[model samples]
Target: MTPAKTQFSLPDDFNPETLMVAKVTEFGVFHEVRRAAHLAADLVANGAPADLDLAEQILAQVLDRQEHDPADPHHGNFYWMREDEFVEDLNAVEFVLEALIPMMIRHAARLTPALQERLLAAIKLGLMEVARLDVLVAYTNIAALGVLNTCLGGELLQTPEIATRGFGKLLAWIDYTNRSGHPLEYNSPTYTAVTLRSLKLLTDLTADAPTRQAARALTARLGLSAALHIHSGTGRWAGPHGRAYQPTIVCETAPEVERLRAWLTDGTLPRWLASFVDRPMASFSIQETAERSRGIALTTHQTPTFALGVASQSFHPQANVLMLHYARPNAPRPGVLYSRYLLDDKWFGDAYHATDRTKMLNLPDEGRFLGVQEVNRAIGLYAQIGADHFASAKGVLIWTGRDEIDEIWVGEECITELPHRLDVDQAVVVARR
Candidate 1:
């Protein structure tokens, strides 16, 4: 078959100005990720009925999709509509190949060594292929291979090769994230859950390997970084500060989600990973410039009743601003977010995405939570955002609004600039749900 030519012309109505194509995923694959993940979790928890029959069935489904044409055309083909699909695909591979396949081979009686070898070869090729296209995802793909090598054999196919690079890079990323105090993986709202699953896979797969100790350390540090957002009252996520969330089928109905719920409700990660995390800290702080050059500086304060994720800038010119989460106890993983902005709840209503980037302060950070406002520049319309350190019970943000913009925003939703040039200070308090 002749290679398909790639060509496209923007339509007359297409607005290049409005298109932020990088944020979109041309296809969705997380449903299978979640399903495959749940199957693995179930097998781990308790599922040896008939030599792990249920687990085997799930593994077969994943392998079949490995070669089959996906319902979404972008998935099967080498070419992609956008780069994030590459991310989606590699993440999918992490769930199935890195995650499910290893668990099955380790425990399930039905998955033979011969079958495992075939799957490993195919996965290796996919990682190489995708690496050629997008190296970032390849970084993760290498970690996936490391995991495969760990479960299948000590001296597996790619040992001391791509496996080493992948493990090393991932550890470095964890180190940078923790040390710099910057939000990671795009500083995405749903990222904590997404990343937690991956770390869990890596940690569990390499249980006996040389990399296990480092992997466990990275996992613990990452968990702490993410846990800063868990709310004590509502147990929901804070808000989408970076990219707005892409729809994923990894929902509450998933068995894995249920398992996580059970664990968060009364337990920590399986004893091994949990050994370090131990108990939730009273409060921890994170302040840094994010990895992708996006600006983010935030702090988390956890009281027995409320875990507050606090930040200076909720929106900035370069970085997606931070949104704080104060969750109810035992709510759920990736719980509903506590809003950071004091929006007109009657006008805008209390929604999860409400705390997204609105026209706000562009306070650049020099480090350690101080965003200096010059009064001349702004992220969009708002001039500056900073936390009022005077009070402790509620969140108080001191903001300097744009004085010249008059009535800022498009129309009815538009906010009127403050009559005065000084910062408008208010307290951000979370209610007990």
Candidate 2:
């Protein structure tokens, strides 16, 4: 049977160049954040992020007295804990909480007033925590405030303290650059793009000229326009390990678009473009091996055969089982074969030594063999490998014909029911020529 057709929606004003830029930038930031979380967790665990003498000094002063106490009952004793253990867990929690703060605030206006107030309190607490640790809260925090401002309309902006703190943070990120030991690691092109967007939003909300100029200056300095062009077109970024980094899409906004446009036209593209080129690919196959002796004879041509065709191969090296398709040449076949290798001579000799009913049932090799779940997994693996290899071979089986059967197909019902079988455990591949 033929597959059903799929449909997709397109934007009214779709431009490939603009869309590409937006997509790359958005994805880049997402990738950076994910990487940062992992990196931060590792660094914290190693006692690196909090090991800095200056940052620790600042943290010591900023934390409450209870936090520093060796035996405070209410403080949870988290601050006084060993740096290695505490930092890793704390950094992970902080990363998640920091990320959630902006996300919660962004969706706050759509929620009930109680939820909005709760989210605001959460954001404030998160901000204080991150600031106390000297961690920079950038575009995410700025965007969260933008959402809150939009929701609250003019009332919240009327407060000078709120306005000053929000605008100040936004401006600081705009001018932010890597300096001293504090690395200005912009997560992705998208992050910078989003920051530009937040600045635009701030300018729109308060008509702040200085913030607008700062945003423009940041765009010029970062060469965001050129970066966007390169990223959207053919440019690539490589990580420290010489692996190409592919960004994931997350945020798409007007400011991001503008920044991308500017990056393409301007000459400030980053040097990491060389890392995005094509790489290599690999594939694998399987074969059957056996031993022939007088009474221990086991050949594929032998009659009363308890053998079957090979089903699937695994991508990983440690995986041992192979799925078998039990469909006959013309009959409406319903069964599947799960062949397992007998590692021990004692088990094989005792199990298949005789066809006695009682003996066969009691044999460990026969009874404790392949399970149903394994048989199903093998079938699924067969389908996956088949499809991938089929496409790779340009719709033709490359290794089949003369002496080797390169490809095979199975019925839909057999594949579906293979998983639900109760008798079989892990499936194994055996020769059945």
Candidate 3:
């Protein structure tokens, strides 16, 4: 079957001036890079799943679009409405492509050897394009891309000449980033951590003892405590000072590095590593307590708005009670409730809750048997009441103002037994039923 034609069209209501086209382009690059890395790691840890085939097909379409569509500027430079309008900086494209190379290799390995060979051939061409780009490449991007290439060099189909060139470019990028006094946009504690990580991977794969030693020395300079302190204050892993600074996904790095270090040295990654690595490193303790339902004990600690992305919901009796406890600096504050449920096999819910103040219903038995079922029942009842009778139905309820709700449910029927995403605004008194 012929592939669906890729088209570029601005929305009818598209207002180009209000949109940050450059920022969006950068975000796209960053997202693709991170996604590629994540998928690579996943494939390596758990053999290739069938979904990968689907991903490959999608990627192929994207590649074709990038290659053939003149209307679609290769660097996301053109505004959707004005094809002639071009943005000068296309740095993000190179960074994103560089990051994607390693991910593609990992993906290739999971395929048949013949397919793997074909992928490697395609990757070389892509890498060449990435390397030849004229955009002002950042050290972080170069380092990240270099590390991936180093890790997979032995397995990829690229010529030794191409591999060596790619490696050199990566090193140059890292050197520039490390030495440049300019503040990094992605600077933060986690930025340092991921950079170190990429360096370590490169060191390990290339068996470059000198490079490894240098990277270790740099890491040591970025002290664990210093990184943590920075993260606590700024909620990121990036340069200590820079105007281009922004929040990072990998905010907590010291603990993660320590955990990875222990695992590498002792041959066992703690089960806690999974959650610990994902959480804001500084707030790991609070997150853990929230997950374990040990909220009452954690009252002494400060709590912020809790946001959790649920991967699976198949645990136990209290599984439904996904308690999110936040600490208020002053007296008791009302809690906000927002839930994303799977309806008819498709997930739906406002990204933000519309109701802001739902009266907290006192548990029927004064905290005797409050559990998941009771909490869900309360929530379900709230949904049934047409946004009015929610409080009268027993149990705590909160009205997320319409402005707060961002997602819309998209399914024909209510879905159960699927994971739900939840976001709560304040500390909730999860009383026992």
Candidate 4:
């Protein structure tokens, strides 16, 4: 049944007409439509006539689910999941295009006439929705991706108006980034990867010279920002991430690093940026600062053996404020030190567990102040007033390699437990390895 459900196989007893009903009707139906879309595209590209027919059927079913009501907010978008009939996924319209646009570009001639007409209409609808949403420049990843969707859709549909809007947004984003000294979602491992993919798509698909040039320059700048944070000894993204999940050592195999390497090798980036990526591991040390936005500042210090990163303040759900990563000989990854607040006994903003945002509290500007006094400062302190915010002032968390660290001290007391709550108003934390 369903060919034993290989990674991309459709469900057994699946019918193009009733798949959605069956999914909702059944208790644990397990089909991944996104993977199926990619699979269908692959089959259409290279499979036999029977396979091509099967691919078309899958694509047709997917297309039927797009919301088509002119008055609906999700007019051109698909549900985040098939069972979701009412909710709208804001990012779905462009992301679905990521799979669909390339198919039209490469295999439009092969598709049957009816399928081609339907596909063309769907792309146009999605493009119009993207223009209506008009994501702001500050929301970096989606804004970059929206630009690509509109520009590419315009090119595909021979609609100059859509292309013009896309280009205007692109220029505005460039201006905002230039003024801010960094992308608004700066140094994010997860989102930077998404932005890189979108930038690459714009450079590859759009014929507009100015848009292509702008995308290339932005790609190069983001690449350099990443290269500076990569610790030579540990081969990890040295932190103070504007947005990141729980993982401490995001490595070379990560999507962002892979994309950065691809951009660096193309020979279009500046020589210095490329050279730094190719540079040998040696006694290197440097401090970098960026005016993150109007009021916040980010500073990072990286050496061959260790790295320390701090943000003056942040509001991101997973902001990595005051992070330290150090080398550990023969270990798979680096030793780590980072801060996490405790809210109602749960780690604040813990990505692993679903936490309630309403009950959780954020630090006030005066309370959230964090910094490293000097470039190589080993001892650092984070001040937070817990009276206003219901969360407790939990001190730093540490993960050490074999023999990397024997003890940690918060003020004068040796910390015996992890994530110790410092009782005083100001606590100085130190990690000794």
Candidate 5:
């Protein structure tokens, strides 16, 4: 069942048995192929889409997001050289191509010859051009190119010089993912999607022996990470880790529907979509500890209704502050269970619905997340509410058991709690409207 080596032209050091698992139990990429296949079958049985405009619409959307001019993609996942005019993210293009791959799988049998040719040509051209531009974006982007190139046919490898560079780059990417505990240095729900999608393509497209050896291993690790991080119940990614956008909003420009409109129509989407992974994920469960750099320790937990991702203060920094993404609330996009990461940008952190914000002055930086569940980031640094200064608010309610309040300088900004002492080991505080 394995394809020929000539098709992949892999590096000599590759290994074939990398990360081979007993069975496949993941989603996302797995279901993506299913969706594509379903669509292809429907098209073949019913004929091409009546609305010829669908293709054009997807194409246009991709074009709009292209950083044809090197503007910051604002949402970045890692460190990379920047150039003003260079295109930054081709994710739109990546999505369109991935969306088309499933249909391409059944093209010969179901698609009209002309339709197949045009669509294939368009998809191939889009991927190749993006590949060229991706040479600048980042390694992950380049890996995106490598996966696309190999799957569509060894076209990028058609020329010897280009082939050497192209395949070589993929080898390097595989090497990086394998050597580093967290291949995705800056993890995010969206970036995880990108990484998983690329790996999915690699699993299917590349040759058997050499090229996939290292790729298989990394794919397995990344795949496990994806399963653990996502809420099985809601099907949404966990946390706004590193660089991520609201998954439901698509792109931030167009808005009107309250869910779609920027938080205040004051035209600031970040304000509204600033909470935790609020959407519903269908089945949730913890897969494993996500291994990352700095011996950071993070554990993932999932149940049918919700998911919990905890990072040891010593290990995971950004997300270590408690994060809970749910699939049970059955709510709209601006999902609740807000994340502490949002508190990083203090200026914009006050999500209208969020209350109970507090800070601890004496805790070590690592322990800060324990007492304070809020966070705000400046440029790249973290700033919190109760860390140093006093924050004033209204209708704050606070209650706790007999445990002495940590000799932490106590400041109750809002007088919401009854003065009567309650009995217990835990503290309960809820800011009411």
Candidate 6:
């Protein structure tokens, strides 16, 4: 099947004058490199003389940002921002290759000989960085894209060793996911879309039959997981997410949702499962053991009116360890309730120090208690810790909705106010509708 032409254009927020400016202290815009690569590719595909010259300028800007020092471990990688000499994110390569690899496959011949050589060398360096970094498959999005970058890069550059390793990593991810019941970054509304896109790329582009077949099956599995969790009433990706940046899915036409919808409507799902997509969902419960030994069992319960999600163990800051989403009357969006740990008035899962900003370590602070739930009603317990562990310890339960709260109870205590701050340590807390 012939692919439809993508009408590429600059982002709405694009600033031509400040395009080259770099911020010193903060992390650079992540999409800058990606957009530049995409623009360059689009211009080259246009094949006009002026377009080719502009593409060269953009490519030059992108290549100049790459770290070329042979002795440096971060060689061939771009910094978090142009002014960031000290920090570099490994995922930079993954993001770049999302556009770069496909461009190389489709429009390499269109590129001027000189520019083509330069772009090819830059991509090879990027792939080398990916090889050295070796992102764990548990990361879901980056790992899947890393596999694609290396495999596709190998095929493009004729490096069999890299391709072989990429294939091996792909198989390992499949094996690990099958055993764990889901990816380590499970039920993430944000990263799941990225992972699915990577898997779709692998399924479409890989020459290897086994890899292609595996990717297709895995895509379907993830799609099923995503389809199940979407709240039928509110149209929100239901809670108990292993990772989520926002509390709720406010927009039904969100890019991630659209991507998933496209794949689902393409007749990939079975007839029985496809029925669930169009019909109203009544009630369901799903339990997934993300990791058996570490006790990361995730459970989500969904009904038409409300949904409850619980995690046996704490994850990253993006995690919703305990979450409740309920339908709001006369409102299209759902109500959100979730939990997070705070230390010294800061999120505990956040980077503890400035140095750990780019790579946040998942510290072992497993003092959190498990939650028990039956449909919308749930109970959560928190354990107390000494000052030695955390400078200031507190657990924050955030609630967002349009409804007025009539009452809140924590083990027979009637909490009379909204934004209730209380010591939940060694106490059972419950909320009901």
Which prediction has the highest TM-score against the true structure? 6
TM-score of each: 0.50, 0.29, 0.39, 0.78, 0.45, 0.82
Q: Per-residue alpha-carbon lDDT of model 3 for 1-433, expressed as tens digits?
A: 9664333332343223422122122113112222332343343334434445534543442233233233444432211211213332343333334334455544555555654554455455445445555333343534555444543453355355655554555555546545542213222333444555555545444444554555454444333322322222222221111111111121212323444445334322223333433335333221111212222111111223332211112111111122222222342322223222221222112122111111121111111112222211222211222233222322333222333333443243332322333344333332211
Q: Candidate order by lDDT, highest to lowest? A: 6, 4, 1, 5, 3, 2
* Candidate 5: regions farther than 4 A off: 1-89, 100-105, 108-128, 135-142, 150-166, 185-187, 205-209, 212-215, 228-322, 325-381, 384-433
Reference-based lDDT, each prediction: 0.39, 0.28, 0.33, 0.66, 0.38, 0.70
What would the per-residue lDDT of candidate 6 be over residues 321-428, giving only the tens digit for each residue?
Answer: 788777877765556777766566653244442322332333223346577766566776666543466567666676664254556676678866656655636353
Candidate 2 lDDT score at position 386: 20
What's the candidate order when arranged by decreasing TM-score? 6, 4, 1, 5, 3, 2
Model 6: weakest 10-residue lDDT segment is 355-364
Number of clashing pairs per prediction, in order: 17, 18, 29, 0, 28, 0
Error of 6 at 209 (Å): 2.3
What is the TM-score (0 to 1) of candidate 3?
0.39
lDDT for 96 (candidate 3)? 38
- lDDT by residue (101-217, candidate 2, tens digit) is 333323334334654464344334444443344335433333433422432232232345544554565455543442211112222343444444444444333444655455445
Judge candidate 6 at residue 330 and give its lDDT. Answer: 76
- Deviation in angstroms for 425 in model 1? 14
Segments of candidate 4 deviating more than 4 angstroms: 1-39, 42-51, 248-259, 262-272, 282-293, 348-369, 378-405, 409-433
**Best model per lDDT:** 6
Residue range with the least summed lDDT across 10 consecutive positions in model 4:
350-359
